[model samples]
Target: MQGFSGRFKDLVRRLGVTLFGIFELLGLPRVPEKKDGEGRGKG
Candidate 1:
C-alpha cells in the first residue's frame, strides 16, 4: 500500500496543476504586481 503522505502530496500536486491550467485558460492573473501609489492615476 502507498504511504498516506505520498498520496496526499500527489493529490495536492495534481490539484495545483489543474487549477493553474484553468486560470491560464480564463486569462486570470496568478500573481498581482506591486504598484506604487504614484502610478495609480496613470493608466
Candidate 2:
C-alpha cells in the first residue's frame, strides 16, 4: 500500500510538471512560491 501511494504521488507530480511546461510554452508565468519567513529582508 505504501509503495502504491508513493507511485501515485510521483504520477501526480509528473503530470503537474508536464502541464506547467505546456503553460510555459504558451507564455504564461508560473506563480512564485511564498517564503516561509515572510519579511525579514527577503523580497
Candidate 3:
C-alpha cells in the first residue's frame, strides 16, 4: 500500500543517514584514485 511504501522509504532514508554518521565517527575516508591512498598512509 501507499502508506507502507512511504514508511519504507522513510526507514531507508533514516538508515542511510545513521550509517553515514557511523562512518563519519569511524573516520572512514572517501574513495580515492589510488588503491593505497588516504587511510593507508605510512605513519
Query: Considering TM-score, where higher is better, how would the candidates rank from best to worst?
Result: 3, 1, 2
What is the alpha-carbon lDDT for the whole of candidate 3? 0.85
Whole-model lDDT, model 2: 0.86
lDDT, candidate 2, residue 41?
A: 72
Model 3 residue 5 CA deviation in Å? 0.6
Local accuracy of candidate 1 as per-residue lDDT tens digits, 1-43: 7799999999999999999999999888756776787447555
Q: Could you tell me how far off, in angstroms, the CA of residue 34 lies in candidate 2 after the best superposition?
A: 26
Clashing pairs in 1: none
Evaluate all candidate structures by whole-model CA lDDT and list the values in order: 0.86, 0.86, 0.85
Model 3 residue 15 CA deviation (Å) reads 0.5
Task: Write model 2 residue lDDT over 1-43, tens digit each, in one string.
Answer: 5598899999999999999999989878856767997656754
* Number of colliding residue pairs in model 1: 0
Model 3, residue 17: distance off in Å is 0.2
